[model samples]
Target: MVGYFGANLDGAKPLNYDDYLKVPQLINLQECKSTPAHHDEMLFIIIHQTYELWFRLILHECDSAVEAMAKDNVVLAEKQLGRVVEIKRILVQQIHILETMLPSDFLAFRDHLKPASGFQSAQFREVEIVCGLKDERILTAFDDQPEALARLKKRLSSTTLADSFYNLLSRNNFNVSPPPERSQTELWQSWQEKTAKELVRLYLAPSEYYEFYRLAERLIEIDEYTNLWRYHHVRMVERMIGSKIGTGGSDGVAYLQRTLGYKFFPELWLIRSYLT
Candidate 1:
């Protein structure tokens, strides 16, 4: 009964482990859509479900990191980003777990997932937006889902990790501004160049900005692990489906390959080129 998960139990009844953790509800969430339920269908569903959970935690840590940067608490911000970097490592490793499924086994239940794709993962989009990958094209995919659209709109309007990092640097007397009257692309290029120069200074004299240097390193690690996840995911898909169209109407491996270039902290990585 739903009452089993209720928290109103007083002295008359002690809280049990199952009730405390909602184990009953959690275990029942996986529902295979395959007729007669193909064995691998459960694996596919659980892998994706687990991915969403990781995305949720990534969003949570990113929010905290942004808040820490807002307060110019670089130590706290770096700590939060450290957790995100570790989570991304786990994500990259976790995608390979899908390789455990034989291609034939996945096909047995693949049809049941048509029109429902990981492309619709709003939380994943939220994570990208929060990390500075705000693409409005993703909004069109969620036009039919009111809650997802609303959440994404809020994320779009929110300050991103890149914004927080730049603001933190500006507060510390770094010149983070781009000159006015440039075209959009030029403006972004100028901004990256400015940030890259400042990052080079940090790299050259890390002891002077040690906290910030560590924070920048964590940002780079997060971006690296994100690309690693994308790479592994594309390889896994290709291994399973071999350039086939995605169930969610995407170009499958090709579409994922395009995402390999996404960078949440471009300036952090660009600094490497100027390190010498």
Candidate 2:
């Protein structure tokens, strides 16, 4: 065990494990709202708290990856994005632990959680925004919480992972900008054609653009794992409550299911279909 203080004579405060981790405060945070607290409520609270902590870390990694990519540091960006992919896998697996609690057991304390829902997790929202999923409606959703709303507003206005990735490509001499004055569909088609051609070139000549090719793969992996996490989360919600409404008045499983179709990097995925 690491000692709190070394034997040196200089007067210094000692730190124990609890002090280092603030374990006392951490353990005390699980306050059960249900009167005659249900046994499963503590488990529910702890699992969700753990998710929020992990979200904080995920956001950190994503922001680092964006900054690295902005500086044309493909290797560092890939490293940070790889960390996010692994963290997403853990997020997918962690939801299963809740399945161990029977639906009836969950209901025993679910009602105690009124109007408060996981839908309002500010950190999770931040992760989505950083990863390139920006929706102004999300800003409206948090209108009641000033701090959370402000953080989300800032993220909404900032450059995202997609912007950084495309910027890196531009720096590498790729013409990623869309043609001017075209209809929305025509612009999309033109952009996709250009991106697909470049991606195919990179795929066929990986040695010529090894760093960029690797960065593209890392980005695709992040998109893949994010969708996987959403898929598993939907199943977990379905298992927990069937079609029942969520604690925050949202369509619980249905809402999660819809999110499964969202992709952070559409051009990356489109390139695969266009590839021979």
Candidate 3:
């Protein structure tokens, strides 16, 4: 039966849609853990599953963009970053679909999800790390999950998108040296000032540095859409369960609200104020 479903047994068959994408396996993964299997539970599972899949694709595009930038291929990096921006738009829109589920409908299955909160989403954290939002503290939560812990550790130790961008600028002869790491907040603020000054120069002579100017704008779009996604997410969560604690032991809406203030590329945003 497994062979009939296009398993690699005998290895003699052409690939079909199910073989290529494993549609059969993918469709079967929505097994509801709720007692009696609440109808809304399926929607909840599929929505979050789709989110993780999109998050995976976003991470792929981000890595590609960073690689392209490292190679001084601004065009390729811009193209890949454009793809990430579009995917984030889709992410923002997807929240509304979950909001369509009435609060009572979610409550029916929410209890079954205790300790399985979206806070534990390893892929989402990977996306954050790849996009330059590394926080070592978050890794402590996944200590029991060795596979995830390993991946997060690798991300923590690696050069992030922000690092690669500055390196790209340095290759182009911009002064991208960051201040000493006395404190993360201080380092970020110092870097922000330095980067904004450089970006302001680029903005003034955009035709001369057309590619870098465009890259900076694309980075700003990424920052903008990320904040939009967070804002929409917080609104959706509040609508679903006002002030309630999250399934993963978080403060739920409050925690998400706090995250809205985080900017992956603050210099990209701050440059606007310095622009003529």
Candidate 4:
């Protein structure tokens, strides 16, 4: 109704997905029960729809960050990344909402869905791959859809945000190639120290990456929240599904637990230890 009933109905032009997607039609909020899907079908639809909305935000941030990076618009990229961090918090917090459903509630609609799972969400997988969680098993979740699988594959092969930061450090005269673990040579150690200093400079002043630092911290925050979300998800799954595997054949709680070890920015984590 926002477009159809608004005064600017004819004038309001939708330029992007968010700007264009009107309610209900794209939302798909209807109960499957109206068409004999399941008892908890409405709830199921709403949860997934909400998850998609979050993915939209994630995509929006990523698009902005990439564009900013293309222009060497460090400040802009940082701001965009910061927003993503906020979105990450939102994603983590949503686990509570998901947990509200009792085992009985989900079991009512469980059978209505066949093979469809969160693992099948293309956008969510894109977010993971973009952030550099490049495990092949994660990509396997979408093998049924060649298009989704291809896109995920492309992102996995692309440079990640963490890679961007390292490249930036190298550009700024702080030679960071393999990071600390692989950096054993004295020359490498010297460069990493210099790189750390340059990072402080880049993230603190004289460049847009200053904003990028704030943004980087936000990303870290997002990771923390996402881990919390996963933890909560595992707990909820236990309460709801027990030891049963995920809908996409993942090991459910065990799978979620495994994801907790994934890191998007290895350099950022290393900096704290190096600096302190």
**TM-score of each prediction:** 0.93, 0.91, 0.92, 0.76
Q: Once superposed on the true structure, which residue ranges of model 1 sit more than 4 Å away at CA?
A: 1-10, 177-183
What order do you get sorting by TM-score, best first? Answer: 1, 3, 2, 4
lDDT, candidate 2, 183-231, per-residue tens: 3668756776777777787887889999888888887888888788888
Each model's C-alpha lDDT? 0.87, 0.82, 0.84, 0.67
* 64-108 per-residue lDDT for model 4 (tens digits): 776666566778878888788777777777777767777877877
Model 4 misplaced regions, further than 4 Å: 1-21, 27-39, 178-209
lDDT of candidate 3 over 34-132, digit per residue (tens):
878999899999999999999889888888988998888999998888888889889989999998899999988898888888888898889888777
TM-score, cand. 3 vs. native: 0.92
* Poorest 10 consecutive residues by lDDT, candidate 1: 177-186
Tell me how far the alpha carbon of residue 175 in candidate 3 is from the true structure, in angstroms, after superposition. 1.3
Q: Name model 3 segments beyond 4 Å from true.
A: 1-12, 178-183
Whose TM-score is greatest here? 1
Q: Candidate 3, 136: how far from true, in Å? A: 0.7
Native-referenced Cα lDDT, model 3:
0.84
> Measured by TM-score, how close is model 4 to the native structure?
0.76
